[model samples]
Target: MGEKPGQYLLWNELRGDWCNYDIVGEQYHGVAIYGLLPDDWSREGFETQRMFELVPEPANPHDRWAISVRADGKTVGYIPRQDCQSWANVVRRVAASGLIAMVPGRIYARDAKNWDEWDGENDPPREFASTVQIKLGDPDGALPINNPPTVPYTMIPRSAIVQVTKEDEHTDALLKFVPGSGYGTLFVTLHESVSGRAASAKPVVEVRINDERIGQLTPQMSQRFLPMIRHLASRGLVTACWGDIKGSAVAAEVRIDGIKANEADEVVLDGEPVTLPALIDKQDDPETYALPGWIDMAVQTGARHSYESQPESTTSSTPAAPPLPPAAWYDDPQNHRMFRYWDGLRWTEHVAPKVR
Candidate 1:
């Protein structure tokens, strides 16, 4: 599998709840949010995951990359500023593409009242402390088996039809080198150029075979792919596909058919022949393939550019120091059978035996 982007923990006390996690068995890498708590908050609501959205707040005067975690339209807390910088590109691109990013969020809390072992050596505060942990990772980290995974995609009703143009010379060269077949395998690569082009010309996706450029996807098709391409570019990866370069010097053609980005892994990783399923028409499967209402509204209303062009404010403000990670049961650094409790500041004597 591809190297994962690595999970990160967001625990800023100022914006969310204290990480006073009660259980020794459960573990999470996420933010701790302040939310409703029962009178006996500790014993309830542990491990029940809820879906939450990560919404970008580019206009927040203090930080342009502020990302708020929300559930059912209620704001839980912000992704810590430091961590937001790492996630800004992905979140911004998804938002700009008119899609919502959702992840599972779980609540962790401790009720000291129910500690069966009343020794009270490492007594937690009497007041209830609840934490919300929402794990974060690359959307497509489990595919391709390369250093970096293939580009990620959200499905649309149908794949964009792109005709590859300007392939006459390239096709002639290929036909000369590999005479009889009159066909070759193709892959996708994107190129950016500012020379002799309009300022607004977007990057172009080229169809290639063995480093030789065969043709290019049409402008409209490139636009449809820009969002996914940009996201993969940011992670030092490329959008890839296994396609066919057919026809001869007279008329060359590149065809990817209905291959989705998610399915590119098998083709790119194993060199397996790609077999795409039939396209689902919006009319035939409106419930499954129809464009969402928000997307329609976004296309009509238009969204602000993903990046701001304004200069940074002259007003100087002190950057907040990163907060300590929430206290929780962690694997013993010394390889003990029991888990050690980290008290936010340092590892303490408190330990709990491992339990399934």
Candidate 2:
């Protein structure tokens, strides 16, 4: 059988022994960037942020755990040796699910120029090296589920779709029990290797309805999820979740509705807003297609308070200042005929003439 797309888990779920690492990558150790550095324009500017794609290089001679970082479709560097092992494992799991492993990275250089322009004899402008900073771990739980379930735990998060393989053998038996609604819950159990197959490194999870065996998770999947399934079994929790049965009795396929690698936690937003980043595609905007970027937006409104009525003082002695507004284009205080960009803090030079 062909390799099925791997299941996805939140960063927390992907944080275990094999892939639990976070570090700022070292770029100059082997001149990793070499000829791949950003163009002259970028080198002559301030720090630039890019969405870096992490590609695992199992065949790399120097380090089998090597992970190459790419930006704008060109190689920039590699994940530091100290963290690549765990990072590679995480990348594999993420890639198996058909999603690219990407993280935000900053490319910066000294003096904001390709080469030092200092002509002074004593303090010859410092080094001209460029470095990129990346963080693989999501320690603060900032990464949310791609498709959260309506009710947590009872069903898998909508993102994980588990299929019961080898359903051909059980099709006849499944006919009678298949409900008219075509939906039912299946109990998951990790069992020893099937009859003549090689003894698996980990136990295989079997999917069953009532007492009849329907099918089992593929060998590859069993190994991928063995860790979490074992954890639940150790806690004496019954592994059961919803599934949808489709196709005629001649040959039926069972697909898990949702599943989770870890148990869900209680979430309370209070009155604060939730903000998320998403990659956008605008048809009319051709530049966006050439350089796609994540769009950040507030998904909820904050609770209104009396403090909002108070005017913000540009110079205040009090340490407790109200939160800054989200980054956006607003009327320029100094330039009445134009609008400047506020990047959640100080005003930026980016501006547009006020629309009449």
Best by TM-score: 2
Clash number for every model?
A: 0, 3
Q: Candidate 2's residue-wise lDDT over 212-302, tens digit each?
A: 6778887776665555555544544334444556555456687653233432211101111112122222123222222111110111111
Task: Quote the positional error of residue 188 for candidate 1 in Å.
Answer: 12
Lowest lDDT 10-residue stretch of candidate 1? 298-307
Off by over 4 Å in 1: 1-45, 112-126, 139-356
lDDT of each residue in 1-356, candidate 1, tens digit only: 11111112221111112222222111121112323333443454443444455656655666766666654433455677667766664454444433445554566555335365456777733433345666554322211111111333111111333566666657654454232345533334443322225867656666555445666766666555555556555655554543444565566566543223332232222222212111111122112232222321110111111112222221122112222333443445443344454555776775444322
Which parts of model 2 have CA positions greater than 4 angstroms off?
Answer: 1-45, 111-127, 138-356
Candidate models: Cα lDDT each? 0.41, 0.43
In candidate 1, list every pair of residues with a backbone clash: none
